[model samples]
Target chain A: AQSVAQPEDQVNVAEGNPLTVKCTYSVSGNPYLFWYVQYPNRGLQFLLKYITGDNLVKGSYGFEAEFNKSQTSFHLKKPSALVSDSALYFCAVRDRGWPSNTGKLIFGQGTTLQVKP
Target chain B: DAGVTQSPTHLIKTRGQQVTLRCSPKSGHDTVSWYQQALGQGPQFIFQYYEEEERQRGNFPDRFSGHQFPNYSSELNVNALLLGDSALYLCASSPPTGRDTQYFGPGTRLTVL
Candidate 1:
């Protein structure tokens, strides 16, 4: 079955410093990778996706992700972080193959991003 | 344009009771998908509705069912709810042209006591 792993439970970054939320995926065929953010008691907000094309995909709130096929990784990155960036981040994957590509997303447990000021 | 929206921001029920959650897709969207988010975990796909039909479903029990209206609104009905059913139910919608990117609603918090 297709799955996503977020390796970290939480990531702490100082304000103005860079931040990285790691994610890895496993799927047959190509992978449709996505990143979402959720504030307290809020729904998942779409950040960005890697369907195809360039290895680096840019997204909302000045965020971006790099899709590495060989490593099967699509890590969310931000050059400089702000305290407002604190929230729960999720990495989701969908296999482009049959039976697995029908709008069903396999998500990682999630990583809590705490941007300390 | 309005994003996806869900009704009854919060709900409390007991075991064996039934609950229905509603969702209004984003403007110009034609597909709606439901997901269950347990505390401290990622959201799990429950099912998806397109053209008022269940186009795809995840590994969930038959006790969970849904319906989609012509206006693109949807509802999730869970019967004989168990304590485990308590979760934050999320609704997502996607445009017909590019259903790849889905936008989610605020979600309804269901607590089974």
Candidate 2:
């Protein structure tokens, strides 16, 4: 079985400051990880993903995340926070062990990123 | 090049009633998946449809069902709804192959009283 966890329920940061939201996962096989952001009453918007290759991956709106194999962590980070970046962030995983091309995504509970201006 | 879209942005229904939610996948996408998001929780997968067939499903019960049309549009039908069924229903779509990166719609807010 595979699962994801966003330990922090909420994280606060000031505009222009760096920010981070932690995420961890468990999978029997190779892991396909992703990060998404959601605005009020809106669906999730794709931010970034880690399939393979480089551990660091960059995505929309200046957001990025690093996939750590040893720690089993994939944390979302931003060099500088913006008020517009404030939203609910989620971490997801796809179990490669299940079957190739199976698009089932297991998501974390979610972390509310509150960026104060 | 439109993204995924869902109809009936907001809905209210009583217990034991049935509700149907609609979804149109992103252009060129052939797979549609349904998810249920309870307040303060992550979205849970319901099922997936491809080529007008039920391709995959999650832990949801039989009461939760769906249909995919030839146009790649889909509908989610919930029977004998319970108050616990009140949640945000999300629709996502992806290409038929490749990495299978899914895109989501704004979602339908269903309130079961």
Candidate 3:
């Protein structure tokens, strides 16, 4: 089974400071990892994904994630945090060999990120 | 172009009642997937439909069902609603073939009383 873990339930960062939201995964085969952000009452917005290639993957809204195979982690990062960056973050993983890749997305519980000015 | 869209932004239903949620895929998308998200939790997959057929389903019970139209739009129907069913229902769309990324809709908030 493919699973994702977000150790932090919530993270606080001051505005303009760098922010990092941690994520780790467990999968039998190669993993397809994704990061999504959710605003209150809204569906998730894709941030980035790591399939294969460069360890650092850049994504929308000036966000990026590092894929560390040895650590089994893919943590989201941003150089400067904005107050508007506050939202719920989710880490998801899927098995590369899953027959129906679109059927299910193993999601972490989610992390609430708060950026204070 | 419009992204994924869902109807009935909010709904309230009583136990034992039935409800249907609608979703229109993105302009060029041919597949639709449904997910249920409880407060403070990540979304849970319900099912996926492509070419008017259910290609895959999650671990949900039989009470949860769905349909897809030839045009690629989809509907999720839940029978015998329970309080546990209360949550935000999200719809996502993507192309069935290749490395298409899934795009999501704002979601419909369902409240079972």
Candidate 4:
């Protein structure tokens, strides 16, 4: 069973400071990892994805994720955090195989990022 | 240009009542998927519809049902709703090909008393 884990329940960082949200995944085959951000009362916004590409993937809103196969991690990072970046972050893994290619995503327990101004 | 859209932004129903949530896929999108996002948790896949048929489903019960029209619009119906069913219902759309990134719509918040 493929799954994702967000070890941190919450991460607090000061504005303009570098921020990181940790995520690790377990999958049988090659993993398709994704990062999404959710604001209060709003739908999730796609941030970035890693599907057989460069280890460091950049995404919208100045966010990026480093996919490490050896570490089994895809950690989200930003050079400088903004107050608006304070939101819930989710890490998801897609099950890739014959027939199971339903595009179903197994998500991790979200981590709340708090950017203090 | 319109991203995925869901109707009844917020709904309130009793435990035994039934409710229906509607969704319109993004322009040029042909596949629709439904997910449930409970408080403090990530979204869980409920099912996916393509070609007016259910292509995949999650671990939800039969009490949850859905339909996808020819135009790629969809509806999610829940019967005998339980308090545990209260959550944000999100509808996502993606192209038939690639099928990698799914654009999400503003979710419908369902509250069951």
Candidate 5:
């Protein structure tokens, strides 16, 4: 079984300050981690993914995430927060090596980020 | 090119009524997936359609069904809807192969009265 956990229900940050949304996962095989953002009444937008290689992966809207294998964590990060960045964030994980199988993403509960000016 | 699109931005139905939601995959994309998102929760996968067939399904009940057309568009049909069925239904599109980054459409908000 594969699953993800985002401990925080909400995160508050001041504008221009660095922000982090924590995510942890449990999977049987190599983990393909992902971050997605969702605004009210809107669908989720892809932020970034960690498949292999570098621990740090940069994504759209000046957001990034660090994948720590030892910790089984993939925490989303931003150098500086923007009011526009305030939204709901989700962490998801999928197992690799099953190429013939359709990928099924297991998602966390979700974390709401509020960037205040 | 237009991104993934879903029809009927909002709909209200009574309990036991059936509803159908539509989705058009992004340009040049061949795969479509459906998800159900409850308030304040992450989107939960309903199923994935590829090559006009249901390739994968989640833990949802059989009352939740779907179809994929030859043109790569898809429809989600939920029969015998319950109050719990009210939520935002989202459609996602991704390439059949390679990176597997799924782009989402603005979801259809369903309200079951």
Candidate 6:
């Protein structure tokens, strides 16, 4: 079965420093990976995606992810973290095995990033 | 344009009670998807509706059902709700091509007591 893994339950970083949220996925075929962030009491906000073309995909709010096919990883990163950047992050992949247009997605457990001052 | 919207920002219900949650797709969107998000976990796909029909369903039981209207709004019906059913219910909308990205609504927080 296709699945995603976010090894860290929580990541702590200082404000103004670089931050990385690691995610790895396992799928039968080429993967359509995505990143989403959720703030307290809010629904998820799309960050970025890697369908094809670029290994490095940039997204909203100064976020980007690098997709590595060889390692089967798509880790989200930011050059400088802000206190507002702290939130729950999720990695997801469209299940290609399903109907081409179903839009079903398998998501990782999620990683909480805490940026302190 | 308005983003996806869900009604009843929060709800509290007892076990065995049936509940209906509504969602209005974003303007110009034709597909609506429902997901269940438990505390500390990622949202799980419940189902997707297109053209007023259920195009696909997740592993959730039949007790969890839904309907889509001509206006592209949707509703999720949960019958005989269990304590486990208490979670954040999210509604996402996509364009005619369902394979594209999904934009989520604020979500309804259901608390089963």
The residue ranges of model 5 lying beyond 4 angstroms of the native Cα positions read A95-101
Task: Indicate the residue-level lDDT of A68 in model 5.
Answer: 93
Q: Candidate 5 versus the native: TM-score? A: 0.96
| lDDT (C-alpha) at residue B80 in model 6 | 99
Q: Please estimate how well model 5 matches the true structure, expressed as its whole-model Cα lDDT.
A: 0.90
Off by over 4 Å in 6: A97-99
lDDT of 5 by residue, A1-117 (tens): 788999999999999999999999999877889999998878889999998899999999999999999999999999999999999999998644234335767789999999999
How many clashes in each candidate?
0, 0, 0, 0, 0, 0
Q: What's every prediction's RMSD, in angstroms?
A: 1.5, 1.3, 1.5, 1.3, 1.3, 1.3
- Residue A108, candidate 4: alpha-carbon lDDT: 96
Q: Estimate, for each residue in B1-113, the C-alpha lDDT of model 5 and write its tens digit.
A: 89999999999999999999999998888888899998877889999888788888898999999999999999999999999999999998887565457889999999999
Residue A68 in candidate 5, Cα distance off native in Å: 0.2
lDDT string for model 4 (B1-113, tens) is 78889999999999999999999998888888899999988999999888898988899999999999999999999999999999999999987566777889999999999
The DockQ leader among the candidates is 6
Candidate 3 C-alpha lDDT tens digits along B2-64: 888999999999999999999999887887889999988888989888778887788899999
Give TM-score values for chain A, per-prediction.
0.94, 0.95, 0.94, 0.95, 0.95, 0.96
* Per-prediction TM-score to the true structure, in the order listed: 0.97, 0.97, 0.96, 0.97, 0.96, 0.96
Predicted complex 3: DockQ: 0.60
In model 4, residue pairs whose N, Cα or C atoms come closer than 3 Å (at least 3 residues apart or on different chains), thus clashing, are none
Please give, for residues A57-98, the per-residue lDDT of candidate 2 as tens digits.
Answer: 999999999999999999999999999998999999975522
**Residue A111, candidate 6: C-alpha displacement in angstroms:** 0.4
Between candidates 3 and 5, which one is better according to lDDT? 5
lDDT per residue for candidate 1 within B1-113, as digits (tens), equals: 78899999999999999999999999998888899999999999999888898988899999999999999999999999999999999999988876588789999999998
Better of 5 and 6 by DockQ: 6
Error of 3 at B97 (Å): 5.1
Docking outcome class, model 4: medium
